[model samples]
Target: MRYFICALFFVVSAAHAQNTTALPEGAASPKATLKDISWMQGHWSGEAFGGITEEIWGPPSGGSMMFSFKLVSDGQVGFYELGHIRELDNTLVYELKHFHGDLKGWEEKDEVQSFKLVKVDGKRVYFEGFTFEKVSNDEINIYAQIGDEDGSAEEVTFNFKKE
Candidate 1:
């Protein structure tokens, strides 16, 4: 029994260690990062594609942030998306999953669209081909490059103002 307990302890510790690996050299710790984009948290609304678009962001917590987006037109929801901004493999990454208005998921349950953070500068955060630019105290412009089936890129832009 004692030997079994010791083996279990080592296994659990190894698993925990893998999940908490330190950031790479020159990488900012989570506590010291993402603060530059604090201006993004809040309820924002705007018009897009003939629809009313809404994005809600929560304050940073646990070295991560969460947000949700929804679009409604003619009193019907078009789609919904949930996103996470977190530290992974010593880098900031944005991951998103989409769902239809009826809550049918678009991606496989185990899959997500991952966007690696490229840089952050004075009121802007760039991730892979996407960007979040703060146009004003209460306004932001987001540009996203979604890949199409034929290996092409499609641009989607949003200009939102704080609600």
Candidate 2:
């Protein structure tokens, strides 16, 4: 989300470093385990940063969940993004690219921001420095945290409801 884009880019690279231990051996990968998160499909909307933000996710398919986000304020678009949660190396990775209101890509044509999966519970997931908590079948909260070298971190949350 635009609200965290700047800080997210700077801090996410350290997510893996701070969370070094991998999942227990032989554990189910997120792709295989996240079938439960199918509830995340459909359109969800919320308010933040004095704007309306919407997220639309496609059902999991081919070991991936694809999504798009749009931010609108005062009847004008702020930004947009495309993202995917993909299974890779027995793990799940959240990767995304940003765009301007007119659809101009932010990163180079082939580059994206990547955050590795950390954990997944019944209705919550932890990825890198990010957390996603499902409040209900129609409500969810997501946020990304930025950590410092001293192991301290600051996070901001985004709340949404199925729409």
Candidate 3:
């Protein structure tokens, strides 16, 4: 009975060690460039459309930043948005996923938008010639003008701030 118990303990311990060793290499370390997105790493709570909206952002799996937005009103889920930002080919890129209330799962809606960070007055960053507007450090104002060939379209702005 003692010999059987000892062998069982050894087998269990060896299995546990093998499972722990399956963790990916470099998973415990973060990259240097990820520091640029440190400003957005937190939980932000706000109100939108008379409902409460909470956004959570964190360092991504591989040196990027993950962003998720959840909105609830009267304890009901309204909508959710998920996205990620990363630097690719010397340009800042953003990919967003959207889901309606009736959708089964999140769907990729927009194309991967790449922007060239143009410094305006050493404080503002502007990325022109895109469907989506610019993102700045001070204020969260997305200015977008769509459905115009002559560039005289309506400006749709969604504003947010640090919380």
Candidate 4:
């Protein structure tokens, strides 16, 4: 029984890591711009983590595209995110801050979680540990590798339909 459990855990962990990846140490981000991801502009909603998720992205402007996200579970707001993809040093970087339902921040006032651009393949934009895949004019998928305080990580997919 112990060996069975261990094998199961390993298989699950490997599957979770397959959808996203972190940038290699000392590797520079790939060159990209807000225009490269302009197709993400618009309002989108989806279900994930057993909840309803919504995101709204503003069109690219002034070298950046701002966005907001929220998750609702059991009809109550669970959390929120505010972020932007911006041009920096000839590359693009995704940065965001998380907040509680009441608007309390999860990170320090001056800190944000950031993902550097990794690649811009056709119909997909791969950021460090995150990916945006456009499925159609009205459908999209976002894959994210979320890490816990204990150093474990899991991949989450959010499938969104334009609204």
Query: Which model scores highest in TM-score?
Result: 4
Q: 49-98 in candidate 1: lDDT tens per residue?
A: 67899999888898778999998988998888888787666557777787
Q: Which regions of candidate 4 are displaced past 4 Å?
A: 1-15
Residue 61 lDDT (model 3): 59
Score residue 115 of candidate 3 by CA lDDT.
32
How does each model score on lDDT?
0.67, 0.72, 0.43, 0.79
Which scores better on lDDT, 1 or 3?
Answer: 1
Summarize candidate 4's per-residue lDDT along 27-86 as a digit string, tens digits: 998888887899999999999767899999999999899999998989988888899999
TM-score of each: 0.75, 0.77, 0.50, 0.88
| C-alpha root-mean-square deviation, each candidate | 13.9, 5.0, 20.7, 6.5
Q: List the residue pairs that clash in candidate 4.
A: none
- Please report the candidate that would top lDDT against the real structure: 4
Report model 4's TM-score to 2 decimal places: 0.88
Give one digit per residue, the lDDT tens place, for model 3 in 69-162: 7767788877676677666654455455555445534433443333333222222223332222224444343333222333233333335555
- Over the full model, what C-alpha lDDT does candidate 1 score relative to the true structure? 0.67
Better of 1 and 4 by TM-score: 4
lDDT of 3 at 104: 36
